[model samples]
Target: MLKKPTSAYVHIPFCTQICYYCDFSKVFIKNQPVDDYLEALIREIKAYEIRDLRTLYIGGGTPTAITARQLDYLLSHLTEQINLDMLEEFTIEANPGDLTEDKIAVLKDSAVNRVSLGVQTFNDRHLKQIGRSHNEAQIYSTIDSLKTAGFHNISIDLIYALPRQTMADVEENVKKALALDIPHLSLYSLILEHHTVFMNKMRRGKLNLPTEDLEAEMFEYIIQQMEANGFEHYEISNFTKPGFESRHNLMYWDNDEYFGCGAGASGYINGMRYRNRGPIQHYLKAIRETNHARLSEEVLTKNEQMEEEFFLGLRKKSGVSVKRFEQKFGLSFDDQYGQVVKELRAEGLLSEDKDFIRMTKKGLFLGDTVAEKFILG
Candidate 1:
């Protein structure tokens, strides 16, 4: 018999405005076609009888962008097959602007044990600079409201490395976020994605961020501050209080199979990878017309999969177990990829503990470059 998948992710693509730096597939819809999307989502969920889903993450442009009534409707769609009561974690990604009193109530009622709120920055100026809708006051209010509504397991999202985002800006934002004392945080270095308004502005010489040196300095600074505040830098981009790490996200980083449903969602199953067509109209139509994927799909090579295991496994602070890696790949790590591993370790990029190969602190500071070494070209 086929075993049930461990996790699931549902993507909701509706957003109020597309951020200038965002590369995510989001639609600025005046009238959200959520009713249509929900029908398709139900269809997709029904097609899969994988009932023992250990975790379910409802994320997006923002899941809370829909109404409280819609949230209830969504929970009803999956409440039966999956063991919500026995589930380890259920996470929802929400925008502060979308969270209301009623929505919080619905989440609590639905057994959504965690929330990852999109609170990019507490400063209003940078919030406007990044095209984020909420301000500092709104963030504080949202946190307060969630706590009052009995949601303690909350994670807040933040971004640094904006064009004018200074060291002081990073410090202020970190301090403000820590002051909230949420159990988890995802602090990201800003990436200037192509075709975005920010990209156009940069090309026209109207925007410039701190140099790579400065950005690296910012990452180091945030790391120090977070550690000083008793937060664990669990993954390169994530920090958390003791025992509060996001289990659903951890599954993704660990390369475990998870279901992705709704527009532009990706799924990993049976050693095959696939993503849906990002264009909403096509995605909606495909789900209704045929049970087919309109996006790219491929099975990875053994080498490709092992290299992925190398890079992604190192993301954890605990790092990858050499024994586990061998078990998954049917070969010893020393037998393959050992040359590159030796070179990196000689240069102090990685360290080996009792049973794992992992990145050093300096290697983590240059994590993108560190990760690049493990990518199979």
Candidate 2:
């Protein structure tokens, strides 16, 4: 049996309302199978060997949206393997509305020490446009409630580049965020994914996003505002107060192995990668019959993993150390990706330090193009 995940990700696929831009595995129903899902999730957890587990992230369609009884069932079971007192970080994704005082109490009483709130935007018009259920009042109430509940480590999420979003709107959102004085902020651009309603709206000419230049301006604006608020741009789309960066997210960007359970979750271990089934009923059926849930599996080739590592590492501002890359791959970075690395450097997209290679601000802006350059295929 595989040892306990060094990190564990639990997927709570139930959401009250699906956001227009969401592409995650989620179920929206008037009444759903939260209990059955928990049972299968417990079976999946018990299927794994518990060892060296250090982090836990309960993300979702909206985890806090689940009934408190469902949460109690899940947390009680997960605590069997995870040492809450010693776990480096345990994060739970919550929406501003879902995190009522009672829900906040449940989390605080549990091993969960961090809250990643989906406070997408403070503007009510924008929130309505994006199909978010929360408002500005809920944002303040959520933050205040969490802080009152002694959750000092809180991270709020924000999105810029919304349909018809203006620079002033972006600036105003930043101001509201700064007013909270939270420790962490994850600001992302509104991405129109293929399967999402937002994309369909665009296809039907109902949605009009900002131009590339405006989007870039929003990106730069977020960086400036967050920095001015004493937050570090440690990773793309992530900013944090000093000494409060998210450890679990860092593990992913560093390409460290982790164990994941719950429907549609993914796991990475000893060079094998697999994702669980997306459908809730199918995953439950699989878990009931086999005691494990899985949908697809792949073993990464050495070069493929390298491309992934570089791309993931470059998401960090500190960048990837050449020595570390070589240590992992058993080949010098220069010897393997030398030509492409040089071209990127020549084009002023990447820079080399004494022991590391990282994207510059320009390359960071064009991360899609820069990532493609590192691909060996």
Which runs of model 2 end up more than 4 angstroms from their true locations?
A: 1-4
Worst 10 residues of 1 by lDDT: 287-296
lDDT of 1 by residue, 155-219 (tens): 99888888888889898888888889788999998888888989999999998788888899999
User: Who wins the lDDT comparison?
Assistant: 2
Give the Cα error of residue 178 in candidate 1, in Å.
0.9
Model-by-model lDDT, in order? 0.83, 0.87
Instruction: Provide TM-scores for the models.
Output: 0.96, 0.97
lDDT of 1: 0.83
The lDDT, on a scale of 0 to 1, for candidate 2 is: 0.87
Candidate 1 Cα RMSD (Å): 1.4
Candidate 1 wrong stretches, greater than 4 Å: 292-294
User: Would you list the clashing residue pairs of candidate 1?
Assistant: none
